[model samples]
Target: MSDLIPGLPEEVARECLVRVGFDQLPVVRRISRQWKWEVESPYYSRLRKAEGLARPMVALVQAQPTADDAGPAVHKGSSAAAATGGPANFYRMVLLDPAEGRWTALPTLPGPMESIPLFCHVAAADGGGRKRLVVVGGWNPETWAPMNSVYVYDFLTGAWRLGEPMPGPRRSFFACAAVGGTVYVAGGHDEEKNALRSALAYDPEADAWTALPDMAEERDEPRGLCVGDRFLVVGGYPTQAQGRFVGSAEAFDPAASAWGPEREEGLVPDGASPRTCCVVPGTERAYMLHDGHLVARDGAEASAWRTVAQVPEDARAATTVSALPDGRVVVIGSACHGGEQTVYVLREEAGKGGAVWARAPAPPEFSGHVAASLFLEI
Candidate 1:
């Protein structure tokens, strides 16, 4: 290989290859079989991470008005309108690199569907240097029917591949999280709109899903978060609630293969919506956007929700909240329904008494309102 690349030694060539940005991998992979193999290997991915060349990126399932559908116009109402038959819009993944202020689109999912699924969840895992983005189940774009599809996108290969269909009945709006290289899904609604208690875990390397013990109670559209090694499922409506969410919560211990006791209330405050909650990566704490304020809870303590900061007044409801490695939190939302979107970063000043929220440069397209979002360090 060193000889093929001329004067460069194999070690130098490897270093050079590992530094290639993920966006350019597809073009570089076409150069030759040797180059393709080198880029696709797990070792190369690890090399990139080890060399501190990997970038942090945020992936979101966003909505934008469909080009042809001009239907009746409505001001900003709820982000849910995008999927629930609001003005004709399409949902797709959009990638943003805060450090570089760059936005790019991954290839459209490999399917014949005209629009992406509604209510799908996305989770990413670090595969050596190559990162994998896994998109889980949601409703059919055209028929509003439940689906069991699973899609995985590999940064190294720059393409999307289908994963095994979710086991059992198709469920949508479930709680999902990526932990220890595996993705765990629990609680959601079945095709008949019945809340579900079953749960499962997926291993991307093996391309298989194994059954986990069922949750203690049926939950629909629950919020899923990874706290330390445990997967916590909180809030969600019961089949009878018919869209009225409860504050009960439970945690699944993979090692014990069982769900711990359920806190009937407090995990999520009464009247606090679960759709606005997210766990800051690496922080055993979960945050929720409630009444224009950011609230947090320590995973070890039950019902310890505390006010963290007030969200920008313009951000009516936090559609998504993500935390950077440095403990800074990024919130995306609009001031009013159908208002211009904005990105706010909450960071602590070294000598300042408390953290402050400041506006961050964001592309206008992101303002369309985020339906779902996740952060992954490349």
Candidate 2:
């Protein structure tokens, strides 16, 4: 029998191929048909994870300036709009390695239209031994209308494939979270701008969405977090209270197929909504960016929210707050909207007071407003 890969035993070659980083997967795939088949197979991703070779990556949906908007100062080969004549306000997915501080642009999402929607919800899912980035409903860039399109990008294949479109009416600004092997989406507004209570869960293996019970109340642009097995949908408002949101939050138990009663008191409190909250994995506490401070609450306790650490004065209203797998918290924001962006990492010391925020280096291209950010272990 011939070796599966060149000049090596089949078993040894497979081990080496699984260790290849996701960034180099595309190039590795082009090496040969056997190499491509091995990389794209479910067994490969499973082996990568089992061997502890998968790396953590941060993906951001960011706005990119067009050639005209960029003032005709084009770099040698770094302009997407200059080559394609796409829309002036374009958005693309950019990946960053927080440890290495390196940035690489992925292939633009393949869609009938050239532009990405506004306020799209994005989540990363590792299911069926495959790692994928899932982008849920958002508004049409050209018409400013709601869309139900669901797109999944496979890191192994370096390609984007459309998943089953979200069932029913178009939704925008929905809350989405990946728990275990499933991606759950809830809330958001419809075409008429009415807040929706509908929710659904998608299984990557099946490539289908299963509708879950509607939320107790209409919530548009709510924040979602998967703590343990429950998916919590936090503070968002109805059409009447569009600007002012309620302080309540609700939790959905997929196993029970029902949503718990909404807590009317201090789930989100004042000045903090779902968009400003994040949960650190393996911790029982949920953190929120509230009034220039980082606050925490025991998920088990109903109303015991307390301050954890003070956020940097400049990063008051952060656009994204993500919890790294290593228990570090990263906050990204700009002094002014779409102006110079700054990233802060908060690390907790042993027996020390609390986490102290330190500035971190971010790519110059990430200075634009971050529409969405997700942390994925690939």
Candidate 3:
């Protein structure tokens, strides 16, 4: 009652508090133990209501080739090699806010597992009362070898918990999607033997692994982008190393039983591995980072390759790309060069000069083996 709770109206205060993030609930709980029940009771109900208004928009997180980031020797080679395995140097994880160009040093992996932080995928999800950014996969740089480790840290908690490892080695491999609370990891170079196309999913709640159907193609550093409900597995290297890039594209429908087909639409060069791709959720069109240019893929008709932007020739090898919520594409990192490069945000422009690229700011020192940014919904 209002009288019993002093100045607060029980029903009104509870609903208002529920709408705020969970991290704020504790402060309110300290008001009184009895008020805690009212605030926490409708948390889920409020979540359901809030989901209605929440739009699935992407935001740029961090970029590669950060100031303190290792070096080029680590991220050099085929995108597959750069992704599916570890660098031959010391492994480290550096957290940076791409928008702010800020940096945070994280504790290294436990024990003597020497490896590089080779493939990184971050996802944004709603966690009870707060938003969470979940970073998955890549190897422990200390081991300097392929690692099956999955570590997740909540910016809210500042605490790290080891998630379930992939079904197979996910080092130097590319492609990760955060659907619901589960993170899907597909394809990567497995130096344990050869390149792999195994698909695995990690459930954050249970901290467990579920083996999904293996991709139709044996791919490494292949691009994984979401189109509608299906996860699109695009171009990457095959088992053989003849610089063969797969032209075929396959779609994985979790609702269905198997992979669809290896089609020409949304396909890359037969031997040119696509390091990254972006899909404007709810649309059929997609974009791929090929060589040093951004290529567009249209699924309905035949997927055609069109260059959108260009980067420095020498920096093509280790560049990472992602799509922003505004439809502008953000590309970062340099492949061959040794110095720190600027993170470019590309907006569509008329004529044939190329998309207008504006350097937002310099990203933190990223580099090393796994140098890419994952979009989180924060």
Task: Give me the candidate number with maximum TM-score.
Answer: 2
Scored by CA lDDT, what does every candidate get?
0.76, 0.76, 0.58
What order do you get sorting by TM-score, best first? 2, 1, 3
Error of 2 at 343 (Å): 1.7
Tens digits of per-residue lDDT, candidate 3, 135-200, equal: 666554434455566666553344556766666554666677765555677877766647777887
Task: State the local distance difference test value for candidate 2.
Answer: 0.76
RMSD of each candidate relative to the true structure = 4.8, 3.4, 7.1
lDDT (Cα, 0-100) at 77 in candidate 1: 25
Per-residue C-alpha lDDT of model 1 across residues 263-329, encoded as one tens digit per residue? 6545777655687677767777677777778877766464477777778787655678887666677
Clashes of each: 6, 0, 31
Model 3 spans > 4 angstroms off:
1-116, 120-132, 169-174, 298-302, 312-318, 349-354, 363-370
- Compared with the true structure, what per-residue lDDT tens digits does model 2 show for residues 113-165? 54556778887887766778888878776566778888888876788888888
TM-score of each: 0.86, 0.87, 0.70
| Candidate 2 residue runs with Cα over 4 Å from true position | 6-11, 29-37, 40-43, 66-87, 262-266
